[model samples]
Target chain A: MSSAYLAAVGEDDSRGGWRPTVDARMVRLESAVEAVLEPHRARLAGADRVTIAPDVHYPFHPSTGVVTDPAVVGAVAAWLDRELGTDLVVVGRSDDRIAFDRTASYLGYDRLAERFDAALVDLADVPTRNEYRAVDGRSVALSVPKPLVESPVIVVPSLRPTEEGTAAGAVRTLGRLVTSGADSSRASVAATQMIDPDLAVLDGTVAYGDDPVATNLLLSGSAPAVDAVATSLLGRDVDADVALSPLLSDGERPVAVENPDGVDLSGVRERLTGGRLPPSDDTHPAVSSAYRLYAAASGDAVPPQLEGR
Target chain B: MLSQFRGRLTDPKPLSIGVLGVGNIGMVHLKSALAMPGVEVLAAADAVPENRDRAERAGVDRTYDDYAALLAAEDLDAAVVALPPFLHAEAVERAAEYGIDVFVEKPLARSTEEADRMLEIAERAGIAVGVDHTLRYQPDMVGVKSAYEDGGVGHVPYASIIRLNDGPLGRPPADTAPPSWPLDPNAVGGGSLLELGVHCFDVLEWLFGELEVRDATMGRTLEIPVEDAATVLLRAPETGTTITLHCGSYQWEELPEVNTRLRLEGITGTITNRDHLPKNFYADAARAALENVASRVGGEPTVFGPTFYLRAHYDALADFCEAIRANEEPPVSGLDGRRSLALAETAYDLAAETVAEDVEVPEVRP
Candidate 1:
């Protein structure tokens, strides 16, 4: 079983409470995901294989469960197949047995990929480069370049860094995959171990201050830049200790996010490489990287590695 | 030592007047010349046969189709050239050469060159030439001049003359086909400027002394190609005073009642006059208006009036006849006519250059 970890963050509604109610956070997460993804299903028709990463649940916001649940992932895949006329595979990850037992009966694990032209990869541990590359090529038909391990990969930080660092596990894994040439396509196909993925996504909805997977902090507001700026203004380093930790070496100081409040993310999703995600499950790292790439390509910024990435 | 050189009117002798052309204006002169003291309607000529018949019906004794035959006749003492603009020079020259005193209609010739040649011939021949700039003779104009001279209009700061009328006496309708002669630019020289503006130009000069136009602007407002309206500004080179005139084919319905206003601004006060009234009327009106307003405000009226009016046309005509009889120069001689025409021509030229510039008539120095 190949599984994926997905993290979601949302705002806490409770006053003078240690944590926000899970039911309220879940509704907000569901609404934001639906708002972001429902309108663009027709535009994301190429993908065939997909995995549902379990949401990194925290006490700050309950909406974070959407990101951690495989049921929601399967539902989104089914929706993409029906609406966009594309096949998608779905897999789930969860620490709780109740969720898995209840969702497994309704989820067609066998026909999840074949009936909808999709597949489910059940994993017991973190994803390796071979696993990701095989699934990406065979399912999504992505021609990732060989030597992607040596290619410059940028990492964007979410607003809140996880206390335990498990919340941004996807960013670290993506960075490793690129460095190992798992997502690359240009190398001799026979010699190439697997294609390296050059991009990563980090969710900062219910971020953790000390240990993200355990101590949840609702920091959802505007775009990723807004949260990053707010956290920086609060004296928290985003790149080194938050979602951007994967791109930093030891003792590497994080740079401040510029004009985070003034950044207009109105059409950010359309200009992004991947389709837009709902606010509950939005990949802040992905949005920021895409923004930096666009800015650099347009000669608006100096030729330096973008901050946070 | 003013000698009374008035001709004797002992008996009403038939004035031997030769009509050069029986056109509308010519016919008027023909009729008027015949009615004058000691006048005889001896012979008449017209290029058109219809005009000759009209002249005959109007009591011309003999009618000739060709003007040359009429000029050749030795019986006439005076001759009137009522031909189009182009024929004026030749007719006037031929009449002068024949030892006949000539009354040439307005616009002496089609060009300044032709006018100069005709005047020269008349001068050399010692024959009297009277330009029918007839507005100078009108009753209202005589009054305006007298009022201006008597200080009735005080210093005469502004003098405006407006002579707007319907189409010229016998002008054909535009839709009925253009006139063969008047429409011909070569024959007519220019349009309303040469034809009718000549009258206003002469009248202004006569009233205000020699007028030097500082600037002028002209425009065409009618269907015809001629200039229908002209605004002129005049300046007295010595006095440094100014006058303006706006004359045109405007006010078609008010053709018969031409309006003129001469305003004078003096060190003491101001005076204004309209139409043709005796100078006394203007002086009286001015003094009364000023005094009545002053007295009502508890101030005394200082102005008084017994104003005079100038009746100069007959006197002007008598001067011409006396010049002919005494073989002396007329007061307003051919040079005077030429000078006025030259000023008028210059005005037209300036008007063409600055269509909106104010036209000022040049003043004559004493």
Candidate 2:
């Protein structure tokens, strides 16, 4: 059965030269996330918990030129509480300073763990970061442990793509969080999801794509589907189904749903029941599945994934 | 009939010539001028002490560290301005002011404005100003001109010239800086085209007749800021014939050969030539035909003739001297030089704009 991972970040767009509206950005993010998640809802329902990594660097609100306050975080927390129940434990990286927002902290793992009895694990504070560091003996290490591996992990990297490939944004920050959390020493995996508001919105109603920082794409309203839709609206090619292919193994394909059409959740459940289990670490190679999907969509052969133990 | 013209060959007095900037190219001209029957090198000057010492070793009796002193003392009929491009305008203007004829090197000045001023000064003084556009004097180029004028290639439609040579920096192990002219944009105007492609452009005009460049582009694909390569598209005014010229400096070998390609689609048949060396029209048709046949079979083009520069210096020098003696216009007029410079500037401007826009221009037919 396929699992759907939904991640979103809310941004404050106070600077206001040329940023998209919050709603528009949300739509784009929703489109992309839904496209990938619609086919895999059954697996998601069976998962232990859904992980969310917020934009900890720069969050702006264009309408009032204010950041996501406690009221805003409470509002989102209240919604997640109502929809996903009290089982949600939002995991974040300690290095993300922007996650320190009072509202975010209020709904953060600490507050949520007490309120809904969910565990809020900061990957940096875990022992996995040091374990991975010792194992790799390299400056840059990304990996996870077995206990955390029980729950499916969805990584949401900062969406800012640079020539050199590393930049501070929702997508990059999320990737860092996952990589840092999964390190043998810092293992805190639950399921990772990266969210950007621009991807959710279809128009230039909010901020344009610029330096991921000082922009609203990395805030709470972000989702992978929104990123794909936003990229498409800007004449860029991005497919959520293909992007999530890395999460599946050979003979086990993840289902994709195009928004504004398709069998919403009801149709997804029907497909999930009949679908086969995704290939395991033993059957599929060690290579990340997302990379395979990316290569295939780009007209290249799907190379062997990460090799087995 | 030929004997009647023999009376014109009189033993005229030798003309005194002064050699300025006794560098490599300057020395070449110096040697050639001294070898001529009615020419004498009155004085030589160079900013470098080593160059002055070398000039003295080469039998130049009067050598000076400064050019102004050399011009003052030497009773010269003509001064050869072989200095760098920046020094050309002042040196030529000063020489013309002294009522001395001047044989300045190619790219007469650093800028088109400077070249114009020099030309104006020389014309007002009634002293001839000859630029060393010696590529025209090459025997192969002469033959090419003859062939086109004689209708050997009927209805010329398109032409192209490719010149790729080892860069001036030389290769590894013997690492050297780029040639002085190209390094200093002010001295050479533009880089590869002004210093080298100027020859190709001149030859193209000579062969195809007057042509207008509908569009052109220049670029620097190397690590340097100055242009190292260029492509120009031109259309003939009379026939509306189209041509593309590609020139660059990036070959590896020391012995660089300029490649020239011409395609002429005539009413009768198409004649195409791509050769490492220049072609000659005076060769026997049977020999040319056999070479073509061998080329087809061997999958290699024929080596038609020797290059243009083999005996070009003598012919060009002779023409300049004759023009002076006969009181006639030089073979390559000043207007020709101006036109070539204008085309080069336009090509550079277009290339800059295209790069800024980051758009590729589609190849279009005239």
Q: What docking grade does candidate 1 earn?
A: incorrect
Instruction: Please write out the lDDT profile of model 2 over residues B1-366, one tens digit for every residue.
Output: 011122253447767888888776676566556544456788888898877876776568888888878888888888888887788888887887788877777776656777788889989988887777765565445555666667876777766667665455332212222344554676667777877677767777776668676666776533344677788887777765788877776443332234444555666655444322334432432343344455454432222111124225544554565666567776666667766777777777777776788666899989
Q: Can you tell me the DockQ of model 2?
A: 0.01
TM-score of predicted model 1? 0.44
Q: Report the poorest 10 consecutive residues by lDDT, candidate 2 chain B.
A: B299-308
B297 in model 1: Cα distance from truth in Å? Answer: 54
Where does model 2 exceed 4 Å of error? A1-309, B1-11, B172-181, B256-310, B358-366
lDDT by residue (A200-294, candidate 2, tens digit) is 21111222232112222222123344333323323333333222222234433222323333223333222222221112223233333643443
Worst 10 residues of 2 chain A by lDDT: A300-309
Which portions of model 1 miss their true places by more than 4 Å? Answer: A1-309, B1-7, B10-15, B168-180, B259-323, B330-332, B355-366
| TM-score of every prediction relative to native | 0.44, 0.47
Task: Quote model 2's iRMS.
Answer: 27.0
TM-score of chain B of 2: 0.81
Count of residue pairs whose backbone atoms collide, per candidate:
58, 78
